[model samples]
Target: MVDRTNADHDVLLTKEAEEQTKNNGLKKKMYKIAFVVQRYGLEINGGAEFLCRDVAEHLSKYCDIDVITTCAIDYVTWKNEYEAGETRINGVSVKRFPVDFPRETKRFDKCSEKVLCKTHSIDEEMEWMKLQGPYSTKLFKFIEDSKDQYDFFFFFTYLYCTTFFGLPLVADKAILVPAAHDEPPIYLSIFNDIFHKPKAIMYNTKEEKDFVIQKFRNGDIPHDVAGSGVSLSEKMESNNSHSLTRKESFITYMGRIDESKGCGELFDFFQRYKKENHSPIKLIMLGKTVMKIPTHQDIKYLGFVSEEEKYNTLQNCDVLIMPSKYESLSIVLLEAWLCKKPVLVNGQCEVLKGQCIRSNAGLWYENYEEFSECLNLLLADEHLRDQLGNEGRKFVDKHYSWETIERKYLDLIERV
Candidate 1:
């Protein structure tokens, strides 16, 4: 009888121990993910960096997220602007390492001119990459040592030094978000290795995925069009206080006010339109300015704005114009659509053109004449603008909802 009681007690204890273990396993994180980017911060609004942050924060709901980045804010100079260490941003852990050296713009440009315009060896191209850098050996060493800690590492933007060097270290567990567009640097021989090394690739758009596959012939690697999501508020209040006048019907441009973004062309076209047609239409620009703003009463530059102000201004605008000729995916375009607004984009950009075609939510133009015509048409017909804007909102709802985006990412992670 004593032996029987002792055996029963042992069985009960064993069952309790097994139950505790099962409970602990259930509470463990689904996966550990690390996002590696060139720059990261609340203030850093560069496309690739911002995309990385958004994706990381969103994914944090399901898994553990860590952002490995450089202490740089300025992309042109690669100047270390953040403290070198780990910190939490909106719940995700961020590890920032100091940039080994700041970029010399003249030297980088000289190197670029040589590499792109003239015959260059792989060695020369690699040198150019180092020059176009947020290079940090400490960051690389940390990645190497800690590779086993994370289930996967997502390296954002193939153009940067961080992705170029860091992705190869954990190629077996690397997922490359190559925010590549139709650009000259991608044709370089060094990129062939970068494209092929990743375990998988996440593209911003189908256009980008197709372009990369054609350029790099990297179709064998698993890839998906896992674009980032745009979260919309339940109610968006349109505040017209930021405008010069509440009654003015203005078109707005939001992004880096730099020449490369086709802002120069936009300024020229808008100024010409104002001159040719004595219309009261104004051009309101908001973002960090890198180029000189033309001195014209019709063109207003509202440097940088808050999120609420941005959406409010978007709601007030007659149209949103994205004049950039090169884009993998324009988040602002999505934002404009989310606000139920029509957009005018540069047709020369295949991604932008394709998006416009796919969604039927915006118009595109290759030249100034087309720009003027499209602008006039959209402004003249309120019904047409409403139709396009409604279609855009539908497109965004079907495709870019946070739930859909998160599912795609989670599915890819599971599959890969």
Candidate 2:
């Protein structure tokens, strides 16, 4: 078995010896593995991108990991923004390939609006997926060519071109982390081939696994629901009071700011709440804002804070809000739990609702009335907030700890 323990820092070694050690690790027969992703970099903020990076980093402690990906940084236009070559990121080797062409998002969206959520022929569905680019034929060719080099392969998020195309080429060694949701694209028949072909599927939640088994008819395929883990830093502690962490209490939203994520609804509800209740609750947004955010004195949009800043912000927040309806796994919610903050999620999201009910860590709302009521209730009862926050932290500690999730990953690889 690969070693998951951190080597002693007391052991002094030359630079040459360090490089040699990494090379020797890669040469080992059982642990050498490749992660095939459509995008891999520090800048990209997509959940799947973060998931791949986090899992790869954690697994590297136990295995020889290599990431093969496209040079594209932005999902909108799959342009080769980063140089196409090999590099090491946080001790993991990453090789990026050039995208053959940039994606036409306009064409994809226009067609997607018509075809997705509606029945269509296999040919039509395949065409829509192809148009959902980061269409890296070069990346696929690399996977096929280097099939013998790695003992195992991990493909993340089944919706993309890389997993959909590359999984079949190395199905015997493939493990897919589909990150599937109850969305329209998942209903496509093409996914059945991709889903069943993988040696095993790592789901983020039991709800996601259920969604897949229902749609893909993959009862026979070996699968496990293991979500991404939250690594506890020395600074992170069980403290959820806004008065202790920030100058003013605020409600925070962290994720891509888009209508699809229900940011518009969040802002509208907050506005209504602001007028109705005279409390000085400010709304702070962190991350990419894709839609027009209404300019409100109480609402502040701070784009992309550092990891340290994010944790501090979470500690200071009244509660974390997840407005998105389409989420296979809400990493942000897990982060909030680690920070000991209660959460409010969309009731429309079965996975989110399921998580809240299972953990007793937060509340979910189906409409604005419910949303406002939940928030007001959470705000009024400090004891209840503290209780929920404690429960969430306990839940995260129990199931989503790095050690637990990492063990699951290693087991999956061993079975493969």
Best by lDDT: 1
Best by TM-score: 1
Give me the runs in candidate 2 sitting further than 4 Å from their true place.
1-29, 117-119, 234-245
Q: Write the per-residue lDDT of candidate 1 for residues 226-254, one digit (tens) a residue.
A: 68788667435555357462568899999
Clashing pairs in 2: none
Counting clashing residue pairs in each candidate, in order, gives 0, 0
Stretches > 4 Å off in candidate 1: 1-29
Compose the digit string of candidate 2's lDDT tens values, residues 1-416.
Answer: 33334443122334654564465342213367899888988777568888999999877766678899999987778889999889988777899999887878788887787677566677887778788867888889989997877778999999989898888998988999999998878877788788889888899999999988988789788878899889658544425323333677788999899998999889999999999998888898999877899999988888876676678888888899999999999988988998888999999999999899999999999998999899999998999989999999999999998768877887777666
What are the lDDT figures for the candidates, one per model? 0.87, 0.84
**How well does candidate 1 score on lDDT at residue 76?**
88
Can you give the lDDT of residue 185 in candidate 1? 91
Quality of model 1 by C-alpha lDDT? 0.87
